[model samples]
Target chain A: MSTAPATTREILIATIADLLDGVRTVAVGASSPIPAAGAMLLRARNEQRGRERVRVIVLGSREHNFFTNGSFELFDATAQGRVDAFFLGGGQIDGQANINLVGTGDYPTSTVRWPGSFGSAYMYYLIPLVILFREEHSPRVLVDKVDFVSAPGSSEGIHRTGGPHALLTSLALFDFDKEKKRFRLRSVHRGHTAEDVRAATGFDYDAPANVPSTPEPDAETMALLRGRVTGELSECYPQFVETLVADRAA
Target chain B: MGEIVSIEALAAQIKDGMTVALGADNSGPAMAATAVLLAQRPKNLHIVCVPISGIQADMLIGAGCVGTLETSAVTLGEAGGAPRFADGIRSGAFKMMDATCPAVLAGLVAGQKGVPFMPIRGVIGSDVLKMRPDWKVIDNPFAPDDPIVVVPAIRPDVALFHAREADRFGNVRIGRQAELAAMAYAAKTTLVTVERIVETSLLADERSAAGVLPALYVGAIAEAKQGAWPIGLAGEYTTDTAEVARYAKMARSADGFAAYIKGFAQRFEAVA
Candidate 1:
């Protein structure tokens, strides 16, 4: 919206905010600064518009989280259909939207181990809108098939009301087709083309004849993101805010 | 009633090859007790990180004290991936029981209720379900053709954690971190390291009583001021991010990890 271009981080934040539209209650897991920022932006905007305020729960935070019973309450609420949206990431993601939060290679003994799966297996099925967010878009990350399925994108005849809604990376945005169990390229972020996404991605996905560039945040949205959202996010993620400040200085 | 004991005594109670349950990062981990346990160097310790953990778990793994680790994840938060944990997994230093956060909690809940297993939704097709042969999948009794996964109860031999305070009566104040209570209830013995031990009953106050873990569950209590150091206790001190970053960097290799542990032991020794 402003003459100054949005940084890749800013673009990603706006994209997540857009994806979070109509989400009433969104919960973010540990160490997720960008998703937390996006949820904060949405909550701030909704409050400004005099609409019903969105409830953003960033876990491991005393200020933001409303849960008193720890993650037990969170899991219970999600099972009861209280939480509307959530975010998940993978060490490896395939075309089928299967996420591998575990390490590469065989089970029990992995070649390259990552942090074990948090609540992705349960949250992905319970939360109506689960966004697959991994900033890295390289072939190693977005693989043809994951070495391990930390949480499958779709289940056969499983009692699942929720699954992958979209996959957002640094290069592009892809919407997951639940029926077909595949990802469709929705839009490419600015400074990146569909070809760039294809080259980086390891698996195949559907793309339109003319893939549109992701829409940038408006002046108002950008203002809120830089001002109030950044201020709120600083409490939980000080280092990430410092980077944003550094980006501004640049 | 739980008796007041020294950290060393508490560590001595945790014998080798016992399944020890630890509190999560925000749930007041007993790092001082962990240090004593590291010094003791117990072998074949099966640690159950109640959902997730950080440097404390990694340190134990790096020190070669743990034989098996059951955790959802082990990370240093903003500091980055836990290098020692990754190294252990790569080298097969200990058996890793990969679990999701909810599953770990569910297993504890099952243990607390003295149930054989607890049924949970949404792990049907995941490899976490595939790997855990102990977790069973069966058709839902209420609904035909609907399937669910039932996780076996995880009753630990010992539950170790830190709390803000423990009264003379051994009722520890755990605040909003109720998962600590689950650990206490599910474990055979509960060892607590508290910042202070007060003469006045924590249960005497109406507000404080809501967050108190009763003496019936506590096996022993140890007074260790600023016990959850470096990681820091919530509302008391902030996590030393720089120190954790240093650990993350230095724990990348066996020698570096040894050096870090040696320095850590020296620091603790000097303090003692």
Candidate 2:
């Protein structure tokens, strides 16, 4: 196994940016900077390339005032629809792509109860391009059945409208199986294999033959990501970027 | 109805056609949604719903508090309930004017700051400007070269919040997100309901005073334990699915909602 450390944020940004190839009108939830930053980078790059730039709506709190600069708030890009895509994160996720942000146990006196499902419960049904990302994939998070389904998957009739389109993780990429109604491995990150991903996930996964590895960041994309990480986003999120830079250097 | 001054009294404040803003979190003070769900206010009562997350928005909209809702996104999870608030937008009953996450925060900030507008970047060539022409993207006409958009302020008429603890004087505290800050700024009148009523001296320490909503801004303070019951608190309970379904059902109809309110009052009476 290649034991080199990987910066989950970098990989996440690169992976999501790849998916942004032709997407427009993405929705982003509040309190998640990584996905929001990734969308911003992709939109910026598209604008420079003279391509039809993507627009993003950071839900709840205004885009700029909450975390980054105020400019991130303006209504500029010019896209149709509320948002076609979204990037999400959570504390615990199940095989069918259901998420649990409420708590680990019961309602009142529980072992762990998070602030209810931030925006997960609603957004999972709306955005056309739903990409749920999680930096940590432990036995606790990757379970056979979520203790609670804070957000529903295709099986719950949520997809009848619009549900999770994708699940991105630190180890691999996954998608919900519409027919059998389960999560299946579509691809693994570079330098990682199917078995490695399964081993990390305590639950059993239906891995397809020839699961492609996530593509490496191209030179142009990497330059942009690196520059932004070393510049704008880094300034706003100094500590997080510092940790990411340290991981890259290490 | 002699004195009519209690937690149950405010139910009368809500008439048939009022626009209300409630306090909501991942948990905490979903009381507004709960109250609405149980009370089953008339459909003629249109609410301009503004929440920090979609869960509350979904609860209220799905329940029907939202005759009109202006929000960014909902659901960060994969399953259950409606996928996105998009279904409402597509159906035509609901209209969604895109607001960037940062802009929403900035709008709330502007509301809190008492500023008319704040200059921001992005959305320069985007639909947000045209769709909501009120959100102007004007050039610094004096400095024609500089490009910026001035986001207008957002101040909701009333803010209703739920907290872990509060004094009768209306001082409140939230453990996780500064949900109260945004509510205080966004709304003109702020109401707080807490799980416990303690001496005002208990909040003397600064460290235990992080998310405190000042008494000055609070119009009323009610002691409602398990106020955020079904909805999970930041470190409290998991969401109560059974209650959500119950509320969702009653929220769908006016009669059903009235019954729910009467029943909820009975339940409150049972415990009271």
Candidate 3:
């Protein structure tokens, strides 16, 4: 019998979980369910593996966030280098890892306006590990160049301690090379090929001779993702849960 | 004890072209103030949203009350993007600062400290920096080899926020959201509207004193029941889903905005 294919969310979560390994602390911003789920799952795995319990701070969640000081508290934590990992997305991401949380085209007068960038630039500098996650892997998202840079992937001239560690797209995962200032295709997600990524991506990147397929989530991981993870995710992202998990079962 | 003003008196305090700062996001927005402001339609006003602005920004921008929106994000979260805000920016209805979230926080910090500017590590090479020339880059004073970015302080004329309750003495209790104090520090005057005014001792009690905003910071207090309605007041109630959706849909166009305001926002005062 053919097993139902894992979701794009699942693949993304697995990739994030892998990235989150050994990371002792992560702070999830508001309205990010996938990253929150991935952090929750990572915490579970740390417990299962008998490792040091990672401190996960899900902003705006009472159950997860212990700090009562709000975003200021989170920013303080980031500034202090206490937060080990974070996630950021953009309307457009270029080869050099420039992210445009701001809209496409000009500033103040944008051709297409996105919900303005919030805290990305600051967090990118403070957090030791920042993972770039954009579920949509298309030319529109992975572009030749962003119309406006919300946050530059590589701050060549700037005083900064943190930047993108890896970029996870639906089609593939790319590890950002800080020294070279470019992304290299680490692996392509299953059911997607390197050619597919090449065709969809607008930026040029160095490709390996043979790109490996991204690993699938194991039974234990899937079990947690479907059961406990889904339950916790529902509290924050009820609608998303209905579609990604509940609807699948139906 | 501070002055306990009416919504009308509060509305009177804001003038055209004033820089206003309101609570960020759905949690602690001063919707009653926003509603009154929408009715007044004072032009050329600038709003400083600490981070996400959501429906409050959308409504103000849609109604054309705001001249400049200096914010990081203005989306409605799971409810989807702020339609009017997106349209206003794409169509060039008003000016935008296009600040990142932490940058705004940093600016607030600078404003609170009464500093000329504060140095921050990020946005040194980002398009956010490129777009905002008003923000400056300076060589790290201690480290000549390193360069840093400094955001100018944002000092708003007014800071308006809604809280769960306030004492008769005008001490506001905002549990779990101590960041509200930063806005109070950044603004010349901080105005608050609360669900009700309890006895001074009620708020002064040990259990609630930690959440109390001393009367010293509050210039005016108004007892407006459900002051943050339509928008959610954290720990009190969730957002009115239908009302928010209705506003989002109706504020998509000029005619829709007028209709929406007349029906919901301004309607409150029109009846009064």
Candidate 4:
């Protein structure tokens, strides 16, 4: 590990890169800077190692996205099983991994409303690796059950090649088991413990007797993240990069 | 035949309670035409966002011009959550038909192809599917036990958008925003606002022809410089982020939203 302490955001990015191993193409949605950074980190690391280049498509970016036919091309490619990995965030996620991007209450007439589902309903089923990401880790977001399933974690008798592969939050990382339709706590981030994760999480999950802290990025990895990845991310997420720099200073 | 009309005249073609489709953020949204529509005070307008939308949808709902909205999502991107859209949905100001991006695009594709419905995978177990009784789950007849969700065709009465340029012959240059072409093809009538009108036909140039939406699909064209103001046209101008951020802040409350709209109307009226 580097002598300089790694920021929580950097650790999360490193964790995301770890999860994205072996992925050929990864698509990050709009307003998702961290995931986009993680994808870029993987691409940068691959370039360093002379490995196969990972195609990272960041939506809403003129430089990152190559889809000429607009969003239709992205959806078509996903339908044809071209997109390998995707990121989905929800207002609420349950023990079963069902996500709620819609709102808190019932159907059309809801007490509170988030942005409606973008493409999760389709992409979650087709993309082979779907990573659930939410920075805020608490019972409010990690609920017992989602009020509305924007996209189910698992479907019965449905042809689904993709579902929630793993969930990464500010506190910890959990891997989803498709057969059990449940999440198992993998590792807690630095400065957080298994007890903290259990206390904050609303849903029950299987946690091993001894959990390990998420590995910190080595000197080389941290150097790549600060240099090349940040530069590429500035095109779409200038403000986010500024904040990341500010966090490092703080 | 397509005719050159004023923005006000183009807005007049959109009657009360008509299903109107608008292009997404990157696909040149007719913000200037939208201003005229808001000024005219059309009612019960069913606004269909090609797949996703931004400030235009927020403004329409804020001004009470829309009775129903069907789209994948309504957001202001970096500006934050669309305050008006969230308020409207909370208060039941209008009916919201929640949909996924692909589903909405698939619906438009079905409408363009003159098909009753299009078979799409996923959304089987989603609450979005549960709310939409119109969407059906059927077994794929060709593949024995394969079940897929089919979305109904979303054929709008009129499609409205802004573009880089168009010819007097009504052919509009949409660039690489193919979803705009999808909306134009699916709608019964297509109205366009352009930055300028070219004397030469768009179809005449082979290089430019691929990106041109033919005059056959376009019902009328109105030349409005900076038609997609506040938003932007690719290679033309960038999004007015400061103005959008200001709108987002002002629109947090009902009174603030009205005041913002009032100022917007006045600003555009002064320009006209």
lDDT of each: 0.90, 0.57, 0.82, 0.91
In model 2, which regions exceed 4 Å deviation?
Answer: A1-250, B1-5, B14-19, B36-51, B62-64, B76-91, B94-97, B140-144, B241-272
Error of 4 at B164 (Å): 1.4
Candidate 3 C-alpha lDDT tens digits along A39-94: 98898888887988989998767778888876678888888888999999888999
Q: Score the docking of each candidate (DockQ).
A: 0.84, 0.04, 0.71, 0.80
For residue A186, give model 3's deviation from the true position in Å. Answer: 2.1
In candidate 2, how many Å is residue A128 off? Answer: 24
Instruction: Mark the 10 consecutive residues where model 4 chain A has the least summed lDDT.
Output: A1-10
Can you give the TM-score per candidate against the true fold?
A: 0.98, 0.51, 0.94, 0.97
What C-alpha RMSD separates each model from the true structure?
Answer: 1.5, 14.9, 2.4, 1.7
Clashes of 2: 45
Q: How far is candidate 4 from the true structure (C-alpha RMSD, Å)?
A: 1.7
Q: Which stretches of candidate 4 lie over 4 Å from their true place?
A: A1-3, B268-272
Q: What is the C-alpha lDDT profile of model 3 across B191-246, one tens digit per residue?
A: 88888888754454787688777888788988777778777777777777677777
lDDT of 2 by residue, B59-132 (tens): 45544556655543444222233322433444544444444444555566688888988765444433334445
Clashing pairs in 4: none
CAPRI accuracy category, model 2: incorrect
Better of 1 and 4 by lDDT: 4
For residue A114, give model 3's deviation from the true position in Å.
Answer: 0.5
Instruction: For candidate 2, give the lDDT of residue A167.
Output: 78
- Per-residue lDDT of candidate 1, residues A1-250 (tens digit): 2346688899999899989989899999989999999999999998987887799999877789989886699999999999999999989999999999988887777888888898888898888999999998899999999999989888888889888999999899999998889999999999989899999999988999999999999888888898899999999999899998788668
| lDDT value, residue B157 of candidate 2 | 61
* Candidate with more favorable, higher TM-score: 2 or 3: 3
Best by DockQ: 1
Candidates in descending TM-score order:
1, 4, 3, 2
